[model samples]
Target: MTQETEAVAEEAFPQPGPQARTGRPPRRGRALAVLGLLGELLITLGLVLGLFVTYSLWWTDVLADRSAAAASDQLRDSWAAGGPAALPSGSPSGPAAQGDPNAPNAPGAPVPGGGPTSGAGGTGTALAAGTGVGFLHVPAMGRNYQVLIRMGTDADTLAEGVAGVYEQPYRAAMPWDASGNFALAAHRDGHGAKFHDLDALHKGDPIVVETRDKWYVYRVDSTLPETTKFDTGIVAPVPKGSGYTEPGRYITLTTCTPVYTSRYRMAVWGSLVRVDDMDAKRTPPAELRRG
Candidate 1:
């Protein structure tokens, strides 16, 4: 009776498979599962990195351009509200970017502070930080391309994509200055990329600045394709490496180099050539009108 009963039970129920006998998966199978999970995690990480790159390089430009345009509008509105007497910034003899009024103005230079500036307006006053000073027009960049000019170059200010007047060790000269360097900075790759084509500016290209009452016209004099980030002298009262040993009404434009990286800097230097008063039409200077 016992033998018959045992045989019947064995036949009815089979023993557990090899996995159950060892209480775990085979080592090879376990390794493959772990590898599959690792591959999935790596793919997820790659996708996240790709998304971040797109947002940083592309989406940021869109947001920055919008902010810059709004700021430009606000600045123009402020100037309009000020009226003729308010004089938000210096006079047009009509444009030195605003800075130390007394900075060295090379003798005989047409833009002296007194006794008939190159144009009509006088050196009126200084513009406050974060305040919109004017608009930058570079014909070489694009026929209609222009960016608002503000008074600060810090991250918070430049992030909005406007060209900022430097206020550090080398106080940037005003656009209407009798003499001195009117240096400016902006992002080249992102944040509106205000100065993206700065490198393309060749000697003699017009660089205009539109203020409340005047249009300051400048011509590119030189271009430094690459420089150290710490080279503050590039924006000095008389920018180094610009080949302009004499003091004069000069303008300096700076931005990051190598496309998307900020590891270095580039600069374009210009000198004021003329100033024109803005009539009722607010017509841009001839340089701006040309396609």
Candidate 2:
């Protein structure tokens, strides 16, 4: 085991020349190939996600707006044909639209747009889901800021890019109701985004509802920046925390808050300030006419 003998043994093995040549590929090569495949897959996935977002945020709005406009046209055509079902039962009489909103309700008093007047309720047949109710006008949104309203607020119903009446949590009153909250909801970003500009609304902003013959104009009274999604009280007969101490003709517009998310809700509340009779031309109210 001397130095001379050790050198002779190393020469016999030739030191393997740094590494023994092998026919099989290195493990690092296989790892790199797998990583390359993964990178390609990730790129494909990213493209798909971008397309989905575009569809959800942009394409859906175009399609929904078309559907809403067509539905609105059909509704107006029905009204022009004078279909009896076009208008709800009851007239703007008694404590419904003419009397004081806070006035004591007379027993069996007729309510506007009709349903059994609940407190400030009315008498009308329950409109089926997707039934077009009216057109909403928000001057603050824009001159052409109008969207059709339907009967139900379900996902399918709201998918048409139309505001829907609160028929589940509560039966929202008609636009002409004397003393009840006529609650409505629509998409905040996609699906026509009827309430996208809701945050731009302020106290005294005009929100008008166009019925077959009347224009119920409401002035934005207050707003709740954020609230729980399960807060059904916002659509109650007299919405709590809506700055309403008593019953009146109120309108509530709600949508998902913080933009493009439904984690919470934001509401803009308004009370009917006046009712204007629609003429043949169907001119908007003064507030709407303003720039």
| Top of the candidates by TM-score | 2
Q: How accurate is candidate 2 locally (lDDT)?
A: 0.79
Write model 2 residue lDDT over 240-268, tens digit each, in one string: 77878877778999999889899999999
How well does each candidate superpose onto the true structure, as a TM-score?
Answer: 0.80, 0.83
Per-residue CA lDDT of model 1 for 21-68, tens digit only, reads 877779978898999999999999999999988887778889988988
lDDT of 2 at 101: 42
How high is the lDDT of residue 11 in model 1? 86
Model 2 steric clash pairs: 114-123, 114-124, 115-122, 115-123, 115-124, 116-122, 117-121, 117-122, 118-121
Instruction: Estimate the lDDT of model 1.
Output: 0.78
Q: How far is candidate 2 from the true structure (C-alpha RMSD, Å)?
A: 5.9
